[model samples]
Target: MAEKLSSSPPARNIFQRLPLLGTGGVVLTMAIAVMGIVQGLRTISPWLRIGNNQAKAEISTLVVQQIRAVSELTTTIFAMETVVPTSQERQWGNFTLGRTDLLYIGYGEVRAGIDLAEINEQSIQQQGETLIVTLPPPQILDQKIDVERSRIYHYDRGFLNLGPDTVPELQTLAQRQTLAKITAAACDQGILNQANQKAEVALASLLKNTGHRQVEIKTTNPTVCAIPSAQGLSRDKING
Candidate 1:
């Protein structure tokens, strides 16, 4: 007698009887929708940026006008570069077991300007078409190292070579040194004087826009633009 053959498995149906999405079609459709939404958002991102920037600038202008009046409508920004070296050592029984040594050629920038906020109604003198504004002494407004552009130019890990792993510490130390050095150098270069002169020109133009045809900005030099060490420090002997 012949034996009956076993029945084969049924083929999968590409389309199910369910409404709307069927056979995992909903997942595919949802993914496509999400991608389209993301693309649309990206296309409009630039406009959003422009709107935010304009709003911020407008707000800044209003606030400045209220606080500073028409005395200092502009500021002078100064930039400079400096290099700093950092070294640290771990010793055992008067013998150096590990040492981390690195030299960073840092690029730092600083801004100095006369504080217009110091100007009040008393500081402004009006005589016919001429307006005289007495500005406060210039000061260091901001200072920071450009970490993205500044980097290690040279390094020595000594014989043990433990520095490769502690690079973050070296970077932090270098940044601090670089800021101090750059600020000192800039001060020695008479950056305050430069800021004063530039500020005068900028304020004059700003005053013109505020209905003052002839504007004069004046300020006295401070007793100390920078500390005593600033003059002593230079690129040639910065390490000292």
Candidate 2:
């Protein structure tokens, strides 16, 4: 009789062979696998961080460009009427000959805003997922005296018209003075501060819409409000 052939057992894979190890060996093997996985993650971490940094940089650049395109962002307008009194006196050797008193009412407007064109990459910063934007100081954008709404409320050439015949000059002076006073008043009323606050709110909203979930808007202390020169003399003067 021919010898009967016996079938051999199938070979076990490494995973199947793991049970052949004692408890201590099994623990050691598992620990080594865990270490390998950790090592792989450690090696990949720096590249992931580098990628994140690059994306943040690109976002910052795009934000700056969008802000620059907005140009001047006017935030506040202060409008009011002020009474201005101007007088020209005629004198003769320390003795008052007469005085021309002009009482004028003037309406003026002061506009304040941020010049977005001044923003650049340096103005923006990234802190993790949050973005920080530093805005330029607010400035007096424009000052104007409304000639249509302004007029000479009272005029007197004191006592027999002894005062100088300077109607046009007095009116022009009143307009100029009105503009200066209005600008000063606006500054005192914290118009720049108001502009800064409004700008923050506006920018926060804008950046959020651009997919930035966390954003911080910051502003610098406003510089001295430089009153605009009297260039509106021709247009601001009241017709006498």
Over 4 Å off, model 1? 1-74, 162-165, 209-213, 226-240
Residue 201 error, candidate 1, Å: 1.0
Lowest-scoring 10 consecutive residues by lDDT in candidate 2? Answer: 1-10
Q: Count the backbone clashes (under 3 Å) in each candidate.
A: 0, 0
Clash pairs, candidate 2, are none
lDDT tens readout by residue for model 2, 22-66:
677978999999999999999999876766667777887999988
Q: What is the lDDT of candidate 2?
A: 0.85
Off by over 4 Å in 2: 1-54, 228-240
User: Which 10-residue window of candidate 1 scores lowest in summed lDDT?
Assistant: 5-14
- Per-residue CA lDDT of model 1 for 59-154, tens digit only, reads 446534654765443355556667778888877789778787888988877677776777655666666666677777887766666766788987
